[model samples]
Target: MSTTPRDRIGLVLSGDVLEIGPGSRPFTVAPGANVQYADRAVEGGRDQNWPELIGQPAGVQAHYDLNLDTDGLAPFRSGSLDGVVASHVLEHVANPLEVIAEFGRALRFGGKLLLVVPDRHQTFDAPRRATPFSTVLTKHREKTTEVDEASIRDFCQAIYGQPPIHPTEVREWHNPAMLDADRLALHRRRSIHVHVWSPEEFASLIVCSLLEGITAWRLESMYFSDHFPARTADEFALVLEKVPFANPNELGRQFVDAWCNSVLDDTAIDPVRLARFEEALRRDCADAAINSLPLQLFAAKHAALGMASTQDRITSLEVELKTTQIRAAEAIAQGKALELSTSWKVTAPLRALRRLFR
Candidate 1:
């Protein structure tokens, strides 16, 4: 029997799962599952995307008062949860790294975190720049608690953010008149797409977060979806595992080594990118392990993806040589076949006469 995408995700998650912002459509990850929910403004919540929720007073009732943006898992004790889920919620939160870290704090050593965020290219955030991993890392490091104004502005402006239509027509765009103090406060409270990222960009951010000690979870797996089992487009999903490590450096280095090894297996990977990722590994050799990592800047595959390598160039040349040799052999065979098909019994005297006439 073929397993569905939901089934695959459900398998990764086990025991005491808390799904944030479940709204109207709560996933059935397990049979007889007592999955708890966390979301603010639960009384009047309704999701337009799910028609069943349209007429309901509350789409999915929140059983917990937990909030990711400010009081991230504050009600839950450390190492209490088996899995933490935040679906389509990160884009709305300003303190994503902090919230993620909070999730890590709440999860047990073998617990998991399932995250799904919008694909900037397919969403109203198309016009915005991918959120910088370094900036978020700094904010996490500083223990930032407030949403930045720049992000709010970008979401509100959303200039030419999607498709070939008029700039103002995008779903993300807000009227300039709505930019007053009270409205901005409400926007900051939640329900706006404030962050944009490609799958690669977000992957880098998550990996960097682990290395930077912003989160205790390591990247277990991730994928970008155009549309399929969920019938949703322009979204990427990630599964993270909370590993037991005495210090961030231990698990971070181990994860990097594994990533580098896996990347080497892919013959198509650009050597330069691989080399850069390896360089990050090397730097930790003589230095303080955690501090040596650039973390937010190209710390993983995404940063390494942007360069060239001698081995890759050599491989390219070898493929070219093989192609040239194949072409030469084909040309020679074609010439011989033409000669054989031209009537092999032509006389020398006829050929001489034809030459004389010319």
Candidate 2:
């Protein structure tokens, strides 16, 4: 029998599953299945009816105070959960990979991890650049705690930075007069969209993270929606499977090698485009390698060469300056000589006689 998106998701989600940030519109799992909801703020708290309060659909009531931003879903036992659903919740978190690893830790072997995040190009974040995978890696490695300030600024500035042209646009600019400290505190306390990504790039991030030992979740299936009939689709969904290999070193290497090979596989089908792609990759790889050099080391190597060029530039400038000074002096001397010449003497006497008559 054909199943709906909810049905498809529910099929694999059974037995001790958890859903993160299931605001007012939680995914339909089973009629009376054991599904625990988690969120930072729930109804009747300081941020009472928080999700609904913010004009969002408040899904299931939060039974656990699990915060994915600072406190990941790490309280759960390793390999204890059957599934995890984090729908449209990752973009608000500070460290995506940390939570991702926690998801893997919570799920049993072959358990499912459902994730959904906004597509920057299709959402209110259209004005911003996609978060680079390299930056993602750095944040993940560092276990970043605070919201990326730049991302918060970008978010606030993009939607509310400019004056509204139409009724549908933003109503007011984001606290233009507020101090930096106040602004950061507000964003930190509230939900902030921290990362932006395309579906393909997001998928690649998951895969690359696994390949690089940054995370243990394996991509199972992925989907992108344009939210058709609407201007843009806001979110992309993906599924991950938990693996239990003690040493994934070989597995990770194989995955990366196969992926690289697959990138080249397109050449057989689309030689023209593939050729250009390959050439671009070569150029980019070389640039990346050169750019990876230590800043100080690179500077030290080039210091002597730079000094030599600077000396040559100074010498060239001195010659030009001398030539200009000489020309100026010669012109001044010519002017002086002309002032005392016969033509000047005759003109000066005639001028004096005319002035006296006036």
Cα RMSD of all models vs. native, in order, equals 7.7, 14.8
In terms of TM-score, how similar is model 1 to the real structure?
A: 0.66
Per the 3 Å backbone cut-off, how many clashing residue pairs does candidate 1 have?
2
Task: Give a tens-digit lDDT track for model 2, residues 120-154.
Answer: 76777778776666776788888898787777777
- After superposing candidate 1 on the true structure, give the runs of residues whose Cα lies further than 4 Å from its correct spot: 1-3, 42-58, 159-173, 226-232, 247-250, 257-358
User: TM-score of each candidate?
Assistant: 0.66, 0.63
Candidate 2 clashing pairs?
A: 23-58, 23-59, 24-57, 24-58, 24-59
Candidate 2: regions farther than 4 A off:
1-7, 30-32, 42-58, 162-173, 176-179, 226-232, 245-358
Query: What is the Cα root-mean-square deviation between model 1 and the actual structure?
Result: 7.7
Clashes of each: 2, 5
Q: What's model 2's TM-score? A: 0.63
Name the 10 consecutive residues with the lowest summed lDDT in model 2.
268-277
